[model samples]
Target chain A: MKKINFSAGPAILPASVLTQAAAAVENLDGSGLSILEISHRSDAFDAVLVEAEQLVRELLNVGDEYGVLFLSGGASTQFFFTAMNLLNPEETAGYLDTGSWSAKAIKEAKNFGKVNIIASSKESNYDHIPRGYTVPDGLKYVHLTSNNTIFGTQFKEWPETDAPLVADMSSDIFSRRIPLEKFGIIYAGAQKNLGPAGATLVIVRKDLLGKVNRTLPSMLDYRVHIDGGSTYNTPPVYPIYVMMLTLRWIKAQGGLEGMEKHNERKAKLLYEEIDRNPKFRGTVADDFSRSQMNVTFVCTDEADTAAFQAAAEAAGCDGITGHRSVGGFRASIYNSMPYEGVETLVRVMREFE
Target chain B: MKKINFSAGPAILPASVLTQAAAAVENLDGSGLSILEISHRSDAFDAVLVEAEQLVRELLNVGDEYGVLFLSGGASTQFFFTAMNLLNPEETAGYLDTGSWSAKAIKEAKNFGKVNIIASSKESNYDHIPRGYTVPDGLKYVHLTSNNTIFGTQFKEWPETDAPLVADMSSDIFSRRIPLEKFGIIYAGAQKNLGPAGATLVIVRKDLLGKVNRTLPSMLDYRVHIDGGSTYNTPPVYPIYVMMLTLRWIKAQGGLEGMEKHNERKAKLLYEEIDRNPKFRGTVADDFSRSQMNVTFVCTDEADTAAFQAAAEAAGCDGITGHRSVGGFRASIYNSMPYEGVETLVRVMREFE
Candidate 1:
């Protein structure tokens, strides 16, 4: 059966991207060499890297003042690298821990320097994003996850703070419009919205560097990657190439503006099916919930949630399984997810009812 | 038109593994979901994780006393994390700087504690692995890279050190029989020798845990990964799955002993071609050179090299383009490189002569 997929990340890539990626895997650029076969430093792969970074800058409205990087290790590596780069020895960095990922990032930051939990919603089991976190003036940088992919919440409006802002936009990047100038840095793992799990995408304002007190390793040195174009060392080549293909797909789908509308509509349709149907209910509080991405909801009977999932699968919708940490169903509507896929999911929900 | 791949990393994977990976990408486990669609926490992926970990132990001849971890970041992250976990803030550790990767590891170590380069080949520009370096007494551990991918060198044997030893076997893990008992730890990024770049294999002796001065991030802490089963967070799932398939392929090729024979023959065939044919000469010393993988050689006539590369490509020997830093040809004859491929290369070499 043709499946409508809702995987959170490494989720759904556009057919064109997949076709291009598959062909590139065998023979990239008609060079008789697989994309995996080319050297990272070769002009062949250099074009891939330059164009990939250029796409990130163009799609996100980032300026040349920002250094866009693609490096190995996922955003999980960034959780610590960002901390090491930004946090001075004596100063404490502030973190707003909204869910599992932000919590991971905050945990990594504590190892480098003094870490202050500005605010967190884990007390409420991450049902909502923290509202009243105070970003201290003397803090090194305030780290926040723009969207909680697991907990089904988002910071609809970002906190306006004097401290340099570092956002882990792993799950929410390219899903909407944002003022790129406000943040000192933004990092994401490409698996969610961009491509695969091997490479991490980092965009840092060039000015925020050089203040780090700790001796950074070449791997941890954002400056090294910025200078070497994220290929200072051999990077995960195939992953970055897929990311380029993904970006191409996103652009062909009408770029960032088109993606926002697509994701918003997919998420809304799925959530509407859940909320309006008697058999199911939405998980998060309505006003604070997210739309340009994941939709989490549950069936009336927890046991029957499995039945709902089975029905959805039988009806050709896939990957609607919710996180075990937060039960029920989660439909992750990333950039490549067609509205028709969401409609199929909605129809699955009605059939289950 | 067949292609013979020798790309340094993201290198050649077994044909069976690629076929399986392609099918898995389309439909994982008959669940009608792509392997990319499933959560790392799902029972299906968890099975893959367990199998990958188990295969590491089986292949390495590591007993139950050791902890095997599959992490997302490359060996670069583990370089510091290893130092962070093993070194106390007040103490000094020993490092043997052979080539590029070891230098990076040494830099990451300085962030945690004092580091002494017990020996270095920097004066030689890393053309060889350093010799005559004895382990310093009272040092936390001795660190070395078993093989240098870029420089095309490998350590033939390790030091009989009183201090515990740690090796970044990133480019040469599983290439031959390792003295598993000699080192407290051995880590490799799974690209050249293992599988792909995203997943890192860290095998650590259990007694060396919990010695660092600072608090640990769950991801950075070796103990955390051990305790949480390396599923500490959403891992690089697809990469891990690919590694699992590669391991299976390795076993099917008669495990490490078979792999050793296969690699030895391939390297011998290529090295024989480079040595006898006046056209080509090896970069590393014959006695201490890598026998199992990464054979880099130069042609006597510079003008003949590009023409030779084109001729080799037409003859189905590809990815033979040498690294830019070390110009000429580098054939990374890792385990997946079929004997037939090497035979074809040898035939081409004979024609060159």
Candidate 2:
């Protein structure tokens, strides 16, 4: 069966990317070497790193002031690395606890430096983004999660801050056009929309680094990667190569602006169906705060949840089960999720209704 | 043409492993979804993680005292994580400066706590493992690199010490049987003998954890990984899946003992050619210290280097070029390297002579 995967992360990739990646595993770009067997220092891999970085720059519309690094260890590690590199132990940083990911980042940041929760949507079960948050002066950076994969909420507007901004854009990184110059740092784990699970893309303003007041571990330091072109130590080559193929696909799809149009169409189609169907209720209270990346909802009668789940499964939908922490259905429509998949999901919802 | 790959790390993997991995990328075991699209929390991935860990335990003959974690970020990040989790800032750890990898680990360890160099071979350009050095008492752990990929040296016997031992077995893991009880921790980047370039296999004794006084970040802490079953966050799923497939292949090739016999035969063949050929000289002076995983040699005329490289390239031998730090040729005969490849390499050397 041709199934539509809606996994929140380590999620669906473009079908063409998967095909090319599989072939590359057998033989990479006619190099007579399997992509698995090639050295990271080889000219073949060097081209992959260069092209992937250039695509990230061109898509984000960033200039030389930004250093793009494809790292491993995921965004879970970035929570600590971001704070450790940007904030001194005695310094304070502002964080918005919008959802689970941001809350985790805030916890990690607190271990390195003092962290002030400038705004929080936790009191309302993170159903919407908090508004009117004050970015206090003297804060090293204002940390935020651009989109909550678990809660299915996204920041409609970023706070106007005196301090530099650091955003974890894991779920919605390339789904829309982003303002690169407004932020000091942006990082995303590649599994969602970029490529696979092994690489994280970190874009940082060059001047914002080297100011940390501690001796950073070589792997933990962003400066080490910026200086060495993400090969300070042996990098995760296969993942980066696959990411390059994905960027190539994204560029062909018209970059981030085109991605926004495609993703918005999918999101609107699903949301409209959710509102029209009497059997389903959207999880997020306000439509403005709903994420274009992950769409969450619940069966209105609650008793029909099982029947709806079975129906979706029978209709060839995968990973529609909601997060265990929050009980409901979540349909992740990342950049790669096709319009037809969303339409199929709507058809299933209507049939269930 | 199918080429014989000899890259030191991120080198050749089993042909069957590659085929299975490639197929999984398209459609995983009748799951109706690409392996790249599945969630780490899914049952399919859970089986992969379990099987990979079970295979490691069976091959290494380890018991419940150890925790096997499939982590991201490679072995480089482990340099600091190992130190941070084992040695408190007030205490010290012992390290043997055997080669480039161990030296890198020592530099990272210094950021966490005091490091005492118990022995070093740098005076001889890391041509052999240092001997006649005593391990001081009261150290937290004694760290070593089991195989020097760059210098082409391997430890024939481990240093005896009351302190817990830590080893970086990045290049030679699974090529032979290991004494798991003798070491408190063993870590390897999976690119070498295991599978791909993203996942790292960490087997640590449970008792050795939770001893460090520092506040370990959730990602850096071994306890978190152990408790969470290496899924505290989204793991490098594709790499881990590839590793599982490779481990399956290893079992089919008979276990570690079978691997030992196979690798020994390949290494002996190449080393014999280096010793007999008038045109070449092995890099490592001591015969007993030479590594079976990577064999480094130099052309006697030095001028013949270019011709030898070209001839090897023409003969379908890939990645035989040595590390830039030291010039000449390094034929990395990792576990996946077949005996025919080594025979071909030896034949190439003889023809040149």
| Fnat of every candidate, listed in order | 0.35, 0.80
Per-residue lDDT of model 2, residues B51-139, tens digit only: 99999999889899999999988899899889989988889999999999999999999988899999999988999987788899999
Give each prediction's DockQ, rounded to 2 decimals.
Answer: 0.41, 0.84
lDDT by residue (tens digit), candidate 2, A1-353 = 97899989888899999999999988888877788878889898999999999999888898999899999989998999899999888999999998999999998998889999999989888999987667778888999999999999998788888787899999999889876767999999999989888899999988988987789998988989999999988788888998999999999999999999999999999999989999998889798899999999998999999999999999999889998766889999999999999988999998987
Error of 2 at A221 (Å): 0.6
Q: B1-353 in candidate 1: lDDT tens per residue? A: 64778777768878767667766666676866666556666788889988998898898888978899988667877788889899987898889888778888998888888999988877866777767656768888899888888778888878767777899988788878877888899998887777766788899988899766677656678887888798766677777888899898888888888888998888888887788999888877654755457888888888889888988888988788887767898888888889998898888878987
Q: Per-model C-alpha lDDT, please?
A: 0.80, 0.91
> Candidate 1, residue B195: CA error in Å?
1.7
Which candidate tops DockQ? 2
lDDT accuracy of residue B43 in candidate 1: 82
DockQ of 1: 0.41
Which candidate tops TM-score?
2
lDDT of 1: 0.80
The parts of candidate 2 lying over 4 Å away from their true place are none
